[model samples]
Target: MAARKRKQSPQHEDQREKVRFYPAWCKRCGNCAAFCPQHVIEMDQWGYPHAVRTHDCISCHMCEKLCPDFAVTVGEETPSSVSRRGAAGPSPGTEGSLVSQDHSPERLAKTPHPDEEEHD
Candidate 1:
């Protein structure tokens, strides 16, 4: 007897991807494919890793964190965020989370330098 195959809708099968791999920076180390908890990634014959079952990705960031070349990224980049990828500033909704307000200009200006302290 043949096993029954589950029917999946086109929309369901085409789930939005939560992980991305940069081909240029990838060294084909296979760490991302090995470390993926859901087996969402697979290695090609040429030792390159690619997402096989992207629908199963849980956005756990395991692949991204394990990649030695930093070739993997596990989030959708909004237009605004893409332009500010490396900008130094507080992310959205984290404005008041800092206990010491370290990023605030006023706090930084008032903070004393350790080297400038009195010797006595």
Candidate 2:
């Protein structure tokens, strides 16, 4: 007998997932937060990052490529994309650094990367 194909869920859809943030590596920098045109990112009480409006994310990869700590990641939420970009890559603020850390959250509740659960 032939087996039937499994049905896919809405969560499995390619465009449903939003960019991911790596809290451990994040230096609390506001690069990704500032670069995001969608304003999807938001700052926590302690000055950490959080994805307040994930659905608004446009997958522009601006936050990913601009993150100084490689803390912000983008693209489909599939295992393949994670593995491809998760590998050991040069840390942010290096030659390919997309954003600078000049702004401070103390002055304002600057945007932050989601997934960074830390308070500050």
Candidate 3:
């Protein structure tokens, strides 16, 4: 039997404010979907959350606060209005750590494999 393709909602330009999802960093924890008051976010076939109802978003920042992975960002679409979490990385006091604090000798001894490179 052939593998069935997952159905994804068709993309559209609704002129709503911006909501960004960093899939690489997303852990698919579903907290964003569970906490959204407007029911805007929906889990994709792979269990990652996507903004299915972008127009309904009210910039409540609930998803921003609830995400343990720091994957979702809610902000307005303006030159001045940048990421809810600063452009560099997650803001202070977020659920996840911006940098890994494990500084044990074992951790410091580990090194990345030569063949592997970080993705963009």
Candidate 4:
């Protein structure tokens, strides 16, 4: 007897805005992939979770809420909230690092440092 093959669903863009995974923060617990309602996440060969079908995402936040290591995040990036890759606010793996607002041009401005000695 042969195993029956499941039919693949048509892919369409959904409500999810962005999906990022911090491999450094992933402990390979597999909760994120296992809990995805849409089955959009998959485990890599090394056991890290990755988005297989981002368009299928429903923005349900099940993966984010279930991640014990905080390795997964699901949020929409508006025009005002857009940031360059690796330059957004705090991410899962970054600890003790200063995070500015999104990568807006204004966010690049040099602000006065509280610890810096003021010049007369």
Candidate 5:
């Protein structure tokens, strides 16, 4: 008999999904890059965060929850969020839902977004 190739299970398939990052919201903070236990995240010239090697991600959510600007939202992409593409939401370049009025721009600018261009 010929040897058969083993099929990958659903659990294994789920593990292969790539991690997505929101670049617009990122403030160039290196928190995600510094905190990644798997070292999956990396910073660009602008200091913004990017997922260089998603396969190494452990789904720790440290990048998402720790993000002060809510710029890094880590989660399984659901059909609902995708379906509502046109839904009204916060504007780009502004701290909409992720921060409160009490938070100042100086503070936000100081904190780097996982996916943001370097700013002075």
Candidate 6:
């Protein structure tokens, strides 16, 4: 008998906004899928969660927080009114998120440090 391949949802997109799954670290606890309000994620035969309706995701990060093993990560969701793609990384849930900050050498160097000044 030939080895059977897992059939997955065909509507997958290559966009940055997605529910990332780390199988190696996953314990298949099903917490993520059950807590999802949008019902974007679904468990397969082996109890592994997969983002089936990624477009419907609100980037709530509910799944990410519910996971006990940190097996899931919800990618940043971009709205039509705003575009975080221009920034360094994905849009964070908060304005002060570190992902939106520019950590480049030039930006870091420009930042002032009180301790760097001579106390004498």
lDDT of 1 by residue, 96-116 (tens): 322232234344334454544
lDDT of each: 0.60, 0.57, 0.58, 0.60, 0.55, 0.58
Model 5 local distance difference test score: 0.55
Pick by TM-score: 4 or 5, better one? 4
Question: Is 1 or 3 the stronger prediction by TM-score?
Answer: 1
Per-model TM against the reference: 0.54, 0.51, 0.52, 0.53, 0.51, 0.51
Alpha-carbon RMSD of each model:
14.5, 15.1, 13.1, 10.8, 12.4, 13.4
Clashing pairs for predicted structure model 5, backbone only: 27-113, 28-112, 28-113, 29-112, 29-113, 46-118, 49-114
In TM-score terms, which candidate is top?
1
lDDT tens per residue, model 6, 3-120: 1232334554653347766544456688998989888788876575777766667789999998997657677443421232232222222354343223353443344445445642
lDDT of 4 by residue, 12-115 (tens): 34433367664445577999899887788888665757787776677899999999976677876543334333433233234532432222333333333343
Task: List the lowest-lDDT window of 10 residues for candidate 4.
Answer: 1-10
lDDT measured at residue 99 in model 4 versus the true structure, 0 to 100: 39
For model 3, how does the per-residue alpha-carbon lDDT over 61-110 read when each residue is reduced to its tens digit? 99989998766778745432343223223322233524342323233223
lDDT of 2 by residue, 12-62 (tens): 454344666654466778887787788777776546566766656667888
Going through the candidates in order, what is the number of backbone clashes in each? 0, 4, 0, 0, 7, 0
Q: How many residue pairs in model 1 have overlapping backbones?
A: 0
lDDT of 4: 0.60
The deviation in Å at residue 19 for candidate 6 is 0.7
Overall local distance difference test of candidate 6: 0.58
- In terms of lDDT, model 2 sits at 0.57
